[model samples]
Target chain A: MSCEKQSPPELPGCQEANGPLDFQLRILSDPRLLAVVRCTVAEFAAVSGFKEDQCRSITLAVDEALSNIIRHAYNNRRDQEIEMRLHADIGCLEFTFVDRGEPLDRSKYCAQPLDAVALGGRGTHLIRQIMDEVVYERVSEGNRLRLKKYLPPARLTP
Target chain B: MTHLLDDKRDATPMKISTRELNGTTIVDVTGEIDMSTSPGFRTALLESLKKTPRLAVNLTNVRYVDSSGIASLVEVLKAARISDKRLVLFGLNEPVQEVLQLTRLTKIFEIRKTEKEALEV
Candidate 1:
């Protein structure tokens, strides 16, 4: 885990003169690290002014995203590396995940319908429901996933 | 509680212990249930289900759970139903409860407020 302050070049709604707060974490793809990552993200969201419930939701979303990377991209390879970056501005929080593993198949990434009682497909659904924006792209090296959650109107100002 | 069937304490992030209470099997789980730990949870649940027709899970100490953990419960529930066994879960914290609600699985599983209630019904 590392923390640094940098101005985001093209973020649309950043209002702070100092720029958005940024934190970066690099960890192995081991599932044991999920709990540690969740704790860090939860505290980071809280420090960025999200309420408790919002913090929990954001934490869960990040956890699910990392879990997906470990399962689908890395194929449960424990030694693989995953990098996560979080940017907090006045209007929204953005998370970017980069992994050097197999790119996820977009056609197969759909969340299963909740009506059916099934196993193993609800993670993607939770991620979609919790985050306001989710985008995935395959880079030359591997994959990148971005998730954004906007703050409420009252909390939008610095 | 008369017999302790299995008590698993390992290097993993979660701990599971099972005991027989009257005629029902009670599984007490402590720690986070996530991708790293859900497999152990599923194994414990399935092993207990095979031993008793009635089972209740005590989640009072579980403060966090993810979709994988919930999926484990769903899998065990499905197996229990197939074998005409009853599975009940109780003592869910807010985060765990919200996960269940978000997944719309709160209605599918038999949930109770306490072990007594879970065992009785």
Candidate 2:
């Protein structure tokens, strides 16, 4: 099993205390699945104590991640298995995407400049903006992409 | 190991409702616009372009949009500019606004806070 873990601050509902509040999803590499997964991510963020706007940003970030995986990693090969794991705690929310497809070239990753009028390549840029930490690793038969978003301190205040 | 939602893939079809006001075509879209749905959006937008030179895309009801959706809008915007037409977008929720901001596209498009202002632009 491929796993990419986020280093979370000691907070309530962490894995050691509340098992990290996780859900595993296995969906075919299909664009039709993006909406459902986005909805699920929104719910996850909302329940994880994120504000409404934050929840929307988080959902878009994860959706872009999955879209990149389907388009780049799997090369748009439908029906291929893609595994996703969502973990949340009081401190942060993390998403891990595992795919048994092509390894991404790290050197060529660049988000287009904002002033430039273009499209179809803004995923990485959006992900970096929405998430606090992003890590990618190549495994034996697949690749792992991990995204983490730290909860706002104001939201955590009781 | 476990699937959360049921297999309801074919449930919601993206709907684009268009109307004419003040010689501008207003396109109100609702539903997710990712790879599966951008084609329809592109077709609708292209058809709408044939009708009027000024277009306003109302995304107030749209909950989600991926890069492909953005690509469709960009294509239409380029076409509109080449033909000396005007395109305006308004009522962008936080998520939609964030996506545009992150991609540095906020400056490239004419964005308004409400339909009234979008029409005025």
Candidate 3:
């Protein structure tokens, strides 16, 4: 796990003026690293004022995102690279994942119904349900997925 | 009546062991279950299912579970239904219970609070 502190990206409503906490993480696309990522992100969220249950939910969302990248984007290649950026502002927390693998088909990215009993395909649903915003962009180099969750007023600190 | 298998890998953060109690196969799992460990979990589950008509999983020591773990449980449950075998899960910590509720899978599986209840069910 390699991580560095960096300036937050310039996205709408997320500005430097908000004093956002920014972090970038780079890791090999190994399934074994999923637990490490979950612990890191969950602790980060907790320090940002999220409750225990909310932290767990956020951790699960991030875990699912990384899992999808390992399975679909990198095609189960453990040696590939995957980068994640976490930006936590006063109002929201955002995660950006970048990977140079098979781009996800936007037209085919719908959450499977929870009523169906399936072996797989629940990762996407869990992410969408847990996060406030889910966006996928096919970049020139690879694919980028951004997930966001708004913080409640009580949880937001000065 | 006997301990069937005990599987633990030095490279993985999961351990699985199984024993028989009153004709029911009790699978005790310890540690986190994620993409790296779910395959072994699935195999252990399926193998236990093959040995008896009733299988009870003890998840009291499991602290975390990812989507892959849930998928493994679903697959084993499907197989149990097909073979007329029983699959019961007990001692789920809060995180594992919430994951099942979030996926709306609590409606499908038989969940108990204790090993005694799991065996009775």
C-alpha lDDT (0 to 100) for residue A147 of candidate 2: 98
| Model 1 TM-score (2 dp) | 0.88
On DockQ, the stronger of 2 and 3 is: 2
- After superposing candidate 2 on the true structure, give the runs of residues whose Cα lies further than 4 Å from its correct spot: A1-19, B1-10
Clashes of each: 0, 1, 0
For model 2, residues B30-100, the per-residue Cα lDDT tens digits are 76788789899999998898789899999987766777888899999999999899999999986677677
In the order shown, the candidates' DockQ scores are 0.36, 0.46, 0.38
DockQ-based class of model 1: acceptable
Considering every candidate listed, which one attains the maximal lDDT?
A: 3
Error of 1 at A105 (Å): 1.5
For model 3, how does the per-residue alpha-carbon lDDT over A1-158 read when each residue is reduced to its tens digit?
A: 11121222346865554476888999999998887788689766755556667778888999999999999999899999999999887778899999999999665565468657988888888998899999999999799999998878764545
Ranking by lDDT: 3, 1, 2
- TM-scores, all candidates, are 0.88, 0.83, 0.88
State how far residue A151 of model 3 sits from its true place (Å). 1.0
Best by DockQ: 2
What tens-digit string does per-residue lDDT give for candidate 1 at B1-121? Answer: 1001122434456889999988999999987899999999999999999999999999987867899999999999999999999999998877788899889899999999888899895
Per-residue lDDT tens digits for candidate 2, residues A12-39, read 7554643468999999999888877877
